[model samples]
Target: MRRLFPVTDQTAAAETTEGAPGGGDREWSLAELAAAYAYPEPEPEPEPEPDHGPGGGGPGVWLRANMVSTLDGAAQHDGRSQPISSAADMRIFGTLRALADVVVVGAETVRQEGYRPARARAEFAAARQAAGQGPVPAIAVVSAGLGLDFSLPLFTSPLVPTLVLTGAAAPADRVAAAERAGARVVVAGDGPGVDPARAVAALATLGHRRLLTEGGPRLLGQFVAAGVLDELCLTVSPLLTAGDAQRIAGGPSVAVPRRFELASLLEEEGFLFSRYRRV
Candidate 1:
């Protein structure tokens, strides 16, 4: 078996020569030594937003969520996202999670993604604490009529609070069931359905200014069509899955156009992670 080594012969020779005494045969000029030892200048940090006068609360922040698909546009492989995410992609996911004050998802996504709804690492907990937030960010689920599993880890996890957003027509029994499993239910829309725009306003009133939405496409399209989403973070996997499963956005064939400006693009392990802000 061949073992992998990080260091090369050139680096080894440099280390050995640098460690030799003045009596050694090799000698270097002052400029040569400085050039070899010079360190790259550090990049400047981004500026922080200044605090505005406190009267009216801050505007609601909306983040559109969707995973980057293959060239064929498939969000998952065999009904799961794990196959599409690499180690570096997982790290980026965690970093995005840390930046949000709340994590929002559609009820279908919560069930499909096998969501645990809590921080899986101590670093995430520590980061939340440092930001004067709870040990885990709140997990918010948007549902219109489907019943959720009360026994799931999302409802039972004591590390974070759960919020269920539903329409006015939601049954009292369903709300009671969610509450029994330690979730607060918020009624947002008229009749018996959830309105994405109203839900954003409700979340803002509940002190969740920085929101991150991880979606299952229908929700993403709804937010986009409603003109509420402010930003989008997508991780494009390299693999191809040719099948009629699901795309990043699913709905009627109607055209729903929304303008967005690219914020940044990152490539890792042949995968592209792109960030965009709504215009």
Candidate 2:
């Protein structure tokens, strides 16, 4: 892989593979990947005991969405993203998951993708401990109806307990079912649907400030529309799938499109891994 944007001396050195035939293709080590995608340092709090509640200045939260799209803007091919993904893309995917404190995903995506519990990666184990984080990031599923198969390993056997984010008005029986399955239920909205901002805040309240959302588009669209998304890590697949498909963000168009600035870009094979921060 090669760094393509905001190239630095160190990152530039990563572009070459010594002793290789062509000397340009190489796999990045986990340390290099982590450094390249490390979260911004937390800002200093003004008060001795900072308040993180609404209107109380706090350490702040960073909610980033990771997604993939084809050259023709298809987020998924045939109801799944695997067909358009590459090996390096999966590497970056794992790195993102490793770095996040929690992963927020929509219920449909969880079911369609056959969700599983986040496992503890030995590569990141020590670093996680030093940072005061759990062995593995928690998985939080956002659902309005709570229509999920609680028998899945994601809910029953996650290294860290899984979370179900719903609303106060969600069906009582369904919520009870989730709790009985050993998943922690969190209410993020007053109505049946979750409020994106509240969901972020609720997770933050639980000490998950480094949030990553592998959206199925609809949930990402809600986060984007709510102005709660801080960054985006988008992978551009070289292939094209021209059939009707959803964009990386799918929902009602914003009155005016939000702008994001490119922070970093990496290329492997023909895929472009791009990171953008809200401008």
Candidate 3:
């Protein structure tokens, strides 16, 4: 069997003549076929909308949570979110990040995903520069107890300002540590733990009108229950994992059905991306 499948001396000659007409020595040049084939240039993407700058907007600010899940509704793979997306999904994610004034996330997600809170596209940077603003969007993390690594990219990056919204009574040492790491700490709640609703209000006061939350299920559920969320951008991946994994919302059971008015649906690479507005 090995000898039967062995490479022969005629292999090179066979390859060279494969595309030539009638097995002749002359080959078809690319120039000869150029007129028959046409390739169109891709359309340029539209410019991103201008987000309300710091302290420029009020409670009417638009808030959106962007997340992706498997067909079985699992947001994470083995308790992590990195495996739930493809390159196309990543490009969409970057576009959403670029369009937002602030990107909010949970501290656990920050630690788990190795979060770097900068806008990862040159177009976004150029837009900001054109608007006479900074190069990247602001990074906001919600930490009820201030439990996170100070040296993480979310806190240490000076190019993108980091905002930590926590309770007033959170540990002073942790607050100090985050401040030392160059994070702008905001006291959002009057009680012992951070209230996400109040945090949203505070962010609006700080001028983050177009806020985007990329979350784990717990945080998404909390915002959904609080009725503070305005828009939902959900991407449904093509694969399905039928086991128990964290969902897009996983907290106290909702009593009645909440309705969302469908805005748009886009399909790409066998994935369905849905946009909805709370009704």
Candidate 4:
């Protein structure tokens, strides 16, 4: 495998865990990772006012998007993301899920990835409980068309009921089918497409304030466009796939460029785990 950079001793020492997949080469330790990528130091601010404003002006949920890409900026090698993933990446992926209240994703990704329900991991059990979180975070799928497979395990067998976000104009039959299949359907917009802002609001109203989005590109673009994306945890796979694969964030190009500040970078087996937060 091609590596963009060599692994450091800190990451190398923490390369494997008991029974974790890719034990021989994976580099992951949440403690070490936290120490490595703690969100950048904040600038001094005046004494903060109470954050209890009315009508969506209050302090809302924080959005963090996790995406993986090749060193050359290809989001995927095939039609799926696993083609460019590593064991270290999977560890970080699970850790992020363990820390979130909901894992937001797009419908296309759900289908393409054959996503299953987020199961409670034994390792994160005590920590999750201490943090007042449920055994597992809920899966929230963003779909404008409501054209999802209601029978999928992701909808029928989740630890928490899976959430389906759609617009008010979505097909009623499909929406009803989703609800009947043991899914929670939330309307985010009155038009055909889901309003990214409203999607965050809906999840927030449900008491899911720590939102994590595992984007399928276009979905991330929507979140970026809405200016609701608060942070991004990106993994740079050390491969060069010379193809027409997409970038991490797709869809229509943003009219204005949005910038995120680098928080930290960690590496193992040539993979660079990076954290960037909206400035």
TM-scores, all candidates, are 0.76, 0.93, 0.76, 0.84
Ten consecutive residues with minimal summed lDDT in candidate 1? 33-42
Across 5-104, the per-residue lDDT of candidate 4 in tens digits comes to: 2345543443443433222343445654433433333334344457844333443468899999998899988888998999878878888888788999
lDDT tens digits, residue span 150-186, model 3: 8977688757679998989989999999999999999
Residue 193 lDDT, candidate 3, scale 0-100: 70
- Model 4 score (lDDT): 0.82
**Candidate 3: stretches off by over 4 Å:** 1-59, 129-133
The global Cα lDDT (0 to 1) of model 1 is 0.69
Show how many residue pairs clash in every candidate, following the order shown.
Answer: 0, 0, 2, 0
Pick the winner on TM-score between candidates 2 and 4: 2
CA lDDT, every prediction? 0.69, 0.91, 0.72, 0.82
Q: Model 2, stretches more than 4 Å misplaced? A: 9-24, 48-55
Task: Give per-residue CA lDDT, model 1, range 1-279, as digits (tens).
Answer: 010122356544554565442211233333332232222222443444567544443453555464657767888788777887777567666666665668888888888888887675565565456656676668889998748998787887747678999999988788889999998888889967888889898987887767778887888777777778777777788887898868887765446577788765555557766767777
Which one wins by lDDT: 1 or 4? Answer: 4
Tens digits of lDDT, candidate 2, 1-279: 777788666555655645332114578788878888899988776654445644455777899899999999999998999999999999899999999999999999999899999988999999899988999999999999999999999998888899999999999999999999999999999999999999999999999999999998999999999999999999999998899989989888899899999998888899999999999
Residue 37's lDDT in candidate 3? 17
